[model samples]
Target: MTGWWCASRVPKWARAPIPRWRNWWPRGGSQGVRSSQDYVRKAGAAARMMLVNAAAARWKVPATECTVERGVITHGPSRRRLRYGEVAAEAARLQPPQDIPLRDPKDWKIAGKSMHRLDIPDKVMGRPVFGVDVALPGMLHASIAQCPVFGGKLKSVDASVAEKMRGVKKVVREGDFVAVVADSWWRADQALQKLRIEWDAGANGNVSSETIAAMLRDGLADPKLPQARKVGPNIPRPTSTTPPWSRRPARPG
Candidate 1:
């Protein structure tokens, strides 16, 4: 749910046989599933509805007559119902359909332009659950220190002092990437400051903003420089030496 760490090795829970179902569940809470349509939030509510339908099937009730509302599965005519969670044990015994029938969009209660968003309440309350909000027991925090320049590599790293710092768990180094793991994020940051790292200057070692501006000026003056998708004929760019205010007024011909 937090990335791919909790994925089932054997995927496809809905199509899997009764015994082989991997008990798939999503841990992203409400905000993790980013569907603009508010139907399915986390565990594919449609599939969960199907599980309710599967349970109602055992009672010889037609699925068309059966309706699921807020995890409660209700049968028609008799109005007999059971919470979906109550029938989960029984649903596990029954195999899912080979071809699951989709609910008609017109009949869907939640599918409409006027349908209200589900997360608006949580967002207003400032408690909207997101992937970054995930916190588990015994979870470790990691912070990475990357090279300043792109495509740059670390020439050398001295992390001996960082290792001895408070709450510093471990220091990992791979190519230009260096990470500090610790008991807390702030402690790891403190440890990072203790370490001294040297980076290998790449091709742009001597390059600066001034050098780039010069290159642009040189390219503008080149008559052979191919014109890109321009709207009109190319005009010479203003030179650094010729300020607009300092230019002499043009004399009449």
Candidate 2:
């Protein structure tokens, strides 16, 4: 109850009180360390408190008198000691306390220090699985071709040749692109290359450097255009500004 919702996924009958430490990392920008560390710290403290409460109940002492260190709880007055694993079952039954105070940074043993990365061994041994490494039983591969010109549309595609190519499964065409599916990526790529396709290059296809330069010049001359910055009123405008290309180059000595 004290931890995040995902803590519920941890089985109550687990042999040890362990936080879901793996979920702390940011995955696909979903969460950052700054945001996750607080939750993890609080949840871990709550779990430790539960174990301490369970041990205190067995010893017939107040939970506050118990101190936890390295998974072992010790009662100061009675000299009683209990391992977290020994009280894990009873602790699981107890409702987690709310708003457990985090330990002081000065007392931290591992955090804010260099330590061995848990993922290094698996990565070095090439044992870690990735998205590209996964393969399914009947998975197909596809190769796509998009219009070469900007603002162009797909006009026509003669897929008869590509459809008959070896290992080619299907040929699909959309508004601006065509795709060839096959048993393998290479076969799909080969089939896609064989297809005869046409694209309708719209008005933008005729755009050239001269047209772009003219547009920039028009924008600079327009008084209605938004000014990037106006430090003060009554700023003097330059009578003329030399274009970079129009300037003569220095002669060789």
Per-candidate TM-scores read: 0.49, 0.59
Residue pairs with backbone atoms closer than 3 Å in model 1 (clashes): none
lDDT computed for candidate 1: 0.63
Candidate 2, which segments miss by more than 4 Å at Cα?
A: 1-31, 34-40, 47-99, 207-217, 229-253
Which tens-of-lDDT digit does each residue in 54-146 have in candidate 2? 999999899889887766789999888887779989998999887688889997766677756677888999987776566799999889999
Q: Candidate 2 — what's its lDDT? A: 0.75
Clashes of each: 0, 0
lDDT, model 2, position 86 = 94
The regions of model 1 sitting more than 4 angstroms off are: 1-57, 61-76, 82-139, 209-225, 233-253
What is the total number of backbone clashes in candidate 1?
Answer: 0
